[model samples]
Target: MLKLKLYSIICRKYKFVQRESIRSNWMKQRKRTTSATSIANINVH
Candidate 1:
């Protein structure tokens, strides 16, 4: 029973970490795209 509880806790933590990594990656991709678009606008002007 104790082992089952520990396993569940570890699983929860792993899932949380995975979610955080995905969010950070998405944020980075968005930032890159926005910067690229801004640069394009400046070149146009």
Candidate 2:
């Protein structure tokens, strides 16, 4: 039973880390896209 509890805790932690990693990667991608669009707009002027 104790081993099962520990396994569940580790699983939850791993899921949390995976979600955070995905979020950070998404933010980085969004920033890059935004900057690229702004540069394109500036070039149009």
Candidate 3:
């Protein structure tokens, strides 16, 4: 009933937030890796 519907909405919202957080973390990690690689290249030259 109503309670079940409310719980489903809350669950969906929580999942959405979790997905965005994971995506943001992945982007941050990628940026750090790319920066590290560039720095390594610079050191090589």
Sorting all predicted structures by lDDT, with the top scorer first, yields: 1, 2, 3
Highest-TM-score candidate? 2
Q: Write the per-residue lDDT of candidate 3 for residues 1-45, one digit (tens) a residue.
A: 999999999999999999999999999998989899999999999
Q: State, as a TM-score between 0 and 1, how close model 3 is to the true structure.
A: 0.74
- Write the residue-wise lDDT of candidate 2 on 1-45 in tens digits: 999999999999999999999999999999989899999999999
How does candidate 3 score on lDDT? 0.97
Compared with the true structure, the alpha-carbon lDDT of candidate 2 equals 0.98
Instruction: Name the TM-score of candidate 2.
Output: 0.77
Q: Work out the TM-score per prediction.
A: 0.76, 0.77, 0.74
Candidate 3, residue 19: CA error in Å?
0.6
lDDT of each: 0.98, 0.98, 0.97
In candidate 1, what residue range of length 10 has the lowest lDDT sum? Answer: 32-41
Return the clash pairs for model 2, or none.
Answer: none
